[model samples]
Target: MKAIILFGHGARDARWREPFDRLAELWRAQHADVPVELAFLEMMQPSLEEAVATLGAKGAKDITVVPVFFGQGGHLRNDFPVLLDACREKFSQITLSTTPAVGENVAVLQAIIDFGASAL
Candidate 1:
């Protein structure tokens, strides 16, 4: 009964969501038991609450929302808490939790560094 939400700060360009879509596909492919959804802070479909509802419908009681942003900027630091609170109030039956922005993870930073080095 656990699910994951990959939350991102959306951009206006339609193509901006391609990576998010791919991430969802990869998650589904690798972790078949846990359902995953992509959500956005703006300019995208399936807002965080909507993603939560989708997972809830799938019988997910515990949900972990991973902020896909590189850093804990304003949206992640300020806007996200408000949105998460709203979702919690609305989806009282579901347990909602979130992790720090992806960029804060050492593995991700190392991957970025490796990719940069590979380009040289």
Candidate 2:
């Protein structure tokens, strides 16, 4: 089976995870066939490894991680590779891959711009 991990940069406030939770809910609702999990780089319940484990338990052999960040900052560019490498080492049976940060997509940026325009 295939699974997805919505990866985010965790914030200090617990409430900061609300959006991630909503994203997971949305994914589950829309894509019931594929399993989804939320993972944070810090200050959260399940780290990347834990998320991978959860999917592995569900019998997921191919896992794709989507970085739900606004840009390819240091966290994505520097820290993420190390975390992914660790997960690979820990879960050698699973095929783990990652997508570019959501912010890198032009459509996503356009949507943000459209939202800002609507607010103005």
Candidate 3:
């Protein structure tokens, strides 16, 4: 089965992951057919490797990683590719793919704009 991993740059504060957790929950509710997981880049648990392992054990073959980062910054450009390569090597059986940073997406930007506008 296909699965998805929401990738984020983690913070030292545990509460920083709240939005990611909510996104995963929302994904589960909306896309029951595809499994979802939240993975972190640093200062967090369930790194990309662990998340891939979890999905692998759960019988997921194709997994797409969506970076929740605000932009294609150094972390996304440099660190993320290295991490993804490692996960691919470690989980050879799984087909790993990824999308650009969420903040760059049109829908995401619009949502942010709408939210800001709503406050006015």
lDDT of 2 by residue, 1-120 (tens): 999999999999999999999999999999999999999999887999999999999999999999999988899989999999999999999999999999899999999999999999
Hey, what RMSD does candidate 1 come out at?
0.5
Residue-by-residue lDDT tens digits, candidate 3, 1-120? 999999999999999999999999999999999999999999998999999999999999999999999989899999999999999998889999999899989999999999999999
Ranking by lDDT: 1, 2, 3
The model with the greater TM-score, 1 or 3, is 1
- For each candidate, the alpha-carbon lDDT, in order, equals 0.96, 0.96, 0.95
What's the TM-score of every candidate structure? 0.98, 0.96, 0.98
Which regions of candidate 2 are displaced past 4 Å?
none
**RMSD of every prediction:** 0.5, 0.8, 0.6
lDDT tens per residue, model 1, 1-120? 999999999999999999999999999999999999999999998899999999999999999999999989899989999999999999999999999999999999999999999999
